[model samples]
Target chain A: MDSLTSPVKSAHPEGTAYGTVLDADVALRFSTLDAEYEAIRERAALLDLSGERIIEITGDAASAFAQRVLARDVEYLTAERCMTSLVLAEDGTAVDQVVVWGRETGLLLESSVGGGTRLLEHLKANADAGVEITDRTAEFALFGLEGPYAWGVVGRLIDGELAALPFESVVDTQWDGVDIVFARTGVTGEYGYKVLVPAESAEQLWTKAMEQAVPAGQEAVELAMLEVRQPVMRHEAGEGVDVLEMGAGWLVDITKEEFIGRDAVMAAFEAAAERRTVGFSGGDTVPAAGTPVTVDGEQIGEVVHAVHSIGLGSALGLLRLPPDLAAAGLKLTVGDTEVTTLTSPYVTPKSWSTPII
Target chain B: MTLEDLRAAAALRQQTCAQIKKMIVSRLDLPIEPAWITDDQPLFGRGLELDSLDVLELYVAIEAEFGVALYDSDMSVFGSVSRLADHVNPALAPSA
Candidate 1:
């Protein structure tokens, strides 16, 4: 099958450039990266995230099947509610971190770009009778609205009470009279919402959302991820680190009687984690992943990911280090430049006049 | 404020700091003990060295636990445990 395309691609003008993500061609930028970053930070930015895959599981055994494959409990995810979950290997290592949306018919699983294929295979291998898995990647398109004004922009386009919607909650809402699944989620830490519309209606939804939001591309989204400390699939994927070491232990439900990788995850938890993921700043240079980190001339760890943070105005990096050397204020050398370990979230969202419920 | 009032406020601030420290250690599963986190230690750099995602998780956890709302403008409050306590104490106190 051909890789799916974003409906808004045709709308981008002459300066727009495209890139590949998860086998799909996506708009990398419409203008300068700084402008796109500002749009998401100061005002609002719309992102075409259709490159991410959506898989549907339908059957009487859908819930049970999810319970078996996912690390988190699915019982709380009633219709219109979503939860971030991990698909773990039998050894308890994370295969992917996905957002599971509860639907009345069954469940919709949204994976990071290029992540659905593996997850689909895992489900098929483990599924029992009465469960049916369908790849709906091309059938729907996802658009995200992010920034301080994201809620306001979405509120103006839709007739519902958008502000009252809690984070991670999904609702069936209308945009320009087209039915769309609106979820209070985004890669950026700002107040954001994601609109999931049928492929045919995606262009219409995007145009309407764009009226109040500027177009942002992958570069801005990635910068936002780093500033907020959100883990990307590529950065988090690897050996030697389990979910606990990745700072996502809350997603695992050890109370579950049985699930894939339960024993391994339990054992990993029992053993002390040798290395942990950390964020660092105060570096003049952005180090690439696998760059060696040294403390007092002794190798302690390596950089997993790093980027020049527009928000923090410094080079920030995600590093994996020995827990003993991971304390704040600990200085380490990355290729001759000294970087100090800092707590994550180089930036925070602006205060809201009304509390987010 | 009067001396008695000052005493009460200081005591309240200390309690709030302790509570926030406990929340951070438990929610983030930090290897260090809560008592080891000094009130003046920076919560981000040169102190706990929490990553950005950890801050996001802590934000959610704090809102759920203390009924306090943190936003981008409030980022400075995270400079230290005492600063966070100073910011969140009013939110946790009984509404006048």
Candidate 2:
């Protein structure tokens, strides 16, 4: 690959009306897919994910305590694979979502930002169960890798072939001889990975990945892939849905074990999910995630993910709607803008999923 | 108005010390007596383990109580109960 093949910059940038990405707090932190691509293809880009919370569970009974508390089976999780689970309130409302990783001695729970303190208190309350809970977020650095060049760069430092690594699995591997946990799961829904390394090693990993990717000519994967991965979840591959929409349903074996939210999912299952997750493509401008999904000016549900797709030259979104309103060709209003409903797997991977050559 | 006057005005918004205490306590859901929280003591730091959520709720409560929206620049007012009273004092009535 040469500089011509891998452009130095993606078409989008921040603070522009054409293609912008804002986070939950309404901060224009991420630019459009083009900006992300330029960052990936040419130089090093950094994203402040300090928003991710971490929980540490130690003590003699940590494993047993987790097996009983989480919605997923922790007993089957080995040192190599990580499991995602939800800690539910008594009413089964999702209080916090956690990614549990097993170490040789104990378990680490990477929790979401909103409920970090509450989840820590809950974990500590299982006192007699002998769980020593602590928050270690300040102690580590979280970074992500995307773009076609990501594998070549990370694989050089790490021992494993990240390309062959299955998604949603956690491997405790060494990068440049430093022990790091590279998770296959990513928010961008691309062939990417997240690495949690010691704070001291962060700069080293960042510098190394940059040196490799720029020369390889692969740019950062586009935000468009985020929408594409949603439909890929339903493609009839290994229990495909991502956790955003009831993918946890396929994770927890109701018959094999008892877990939190089992009863809630079963109860909701018989009645059908009140809302179904769907894909939408609309005007050139994309709405924020929390924007209401509506049709005929009637509010229906909320948007989860939305982004400007350079591939389709329009806005795309992963939205949730009531079963009756989720049919293809059904029109809906995303905020003040109108969007047309589309089939699942909304964008084919050929052009949208990868950089258009 | 003087800081004391604003403190008094903010206090006037509270029907009773018990009511304010209950509002704070219920949000924390901690096992503490209403009498334990005096009007002057810090509602954070060593005395109260008020986490970030509690801090947000406190902002909302202050807004609702004083009818004033807290801005990012107003963070200094949230440093302590005393500071909050000082900030609200100019617009508040006495504790009577």
Candidate 3:
């Protein structure tokens, strides 16, 4: 699979920095990380989510096949609803965290940014007799609006009523006479909305949206996602890291009778977890993955991933530690800098207090 | 800090988180086991999808179970089970 470049790449600012994440070429920064982060946190930011592949599953047995593959129960998911689910391998490791959107015909799975190819292969390998898996990436372009005041953008650019739709709600709506699939969803802990538009209209819509909201690139989006503890699979998932160790078990529904990885998941749940992922923040310098986390000169854990958190004003990342030592409020050392094991939502999201009205 | 001492400190926070999880599963009458709920998963909106009525139930349950009144606290206290533990037992809260 070739790396995906955004459909609206030409519309991006000239100085925008670009980088590769997995199988996609993404805009790392539209402006400065500081400006983009501020827009996502304080106001509204537009996102060209073309990095995420939109694959549709259709045919007579699509529902059953989706149930067999997805870690969540989506057997009765209607066209008006959407949900986030982890697509797991048979060994209980994550393939990707995807947004399962309910379409009238069948269903669409939105792969995590730069995580499409792997998810597509997994879906094909498990294809049922009557299921039809189609890659719709070239047919449509996905755009997102997020932040405390993103609702205002929805009212001016689309519909006011959509601004307050229940989270994960899906609607077939229109923009300037162009049909699109609109959803009330977001990764950053803010008011978020996404529109799936025809590829030809993507640039026009992107230009208009830029007029109302600052265009945030992948770097800033991932940072806000980290602050809220949302799983960024590329940074977090690695060899031998099971869902239990990832602490992303919430994305799976173990109660369901069957799924591709149910047996392994149950085994993981039944067996005691050796290592668990937990959030941590401290140190001016961001530590690299595999950096030893020590206490009193004794190695206890290792950093899974870390970055300079604009919200924490320090290095913010996760640590894979012994289950007993994974709880919050522990004073530990990562390299030369002392760090503290912290609770989730390392930073309080302003959207929590700011109502759509 | 020694591993033994760290274990002891972690045990305290884990116990609080466990208690809160039990209270939530019991109060919400959820279909899954209390142990199934991870310490870091969100309790409302997206993860657990608990509605406003459920929030009211949890608010009362917390006051009764932990003797902590979170009614005046921001919604972020419910960000995750570990987060709620920090609020109910301030000692477990990591300093900003």
Candidate with best DockQ:
3
Q: Give lDDT tens digits, candidate 1, residues A195-268.
A: 88998987777777777788998878888877766667757767857776675554566667788988887787
Q: What is the TM-score of each candidate against the true structure?
A: 0.80, 0.57, 0.99
Best by lDDT: 3
Show the colliding residue pairs in model 3: none
Q: Which candidate do you rate higher for TM-score, 1 or 3?
A: 3
**Docking verdict class for candidate 2:** incorrect
Can you tell me the CAPRI class of model 1? incorrect
Error of 2 at A257 (Å): 3.0
Sort all candidates by DockQ, best to worst. 3, 1, 2
After superposing candidate 2 on the true structure, give the runs of residues whose Cα lies further than 4 Å from its correct spot.
Answer: A1-33, A37-49, A113-115, A125-128, A160-163, A166-171, A213-226, A229-253, A287-307, A333-338, A347-357, B1-96
Tens-digit per-residue lDDT, A1-357, candidate 3: 889999999999899999999999999999999999999999999999999999999999999999999999998899999999999999999999999999999999999999999999999999999999999999999999999999999999999998999989999999988999999999998999999999999999999999999999999999999999999999998988899899888999888899998899899989988999999999899999999999889888999999999988999999999999998888899999999888888888899999878
Tens digits of per-residue lDDT for model 2, A115-192 = 456567666664445777777766776666654345554556564476457556778778888888877654333345
| Models sorted by TM-score, best on top | 3, 1, 2
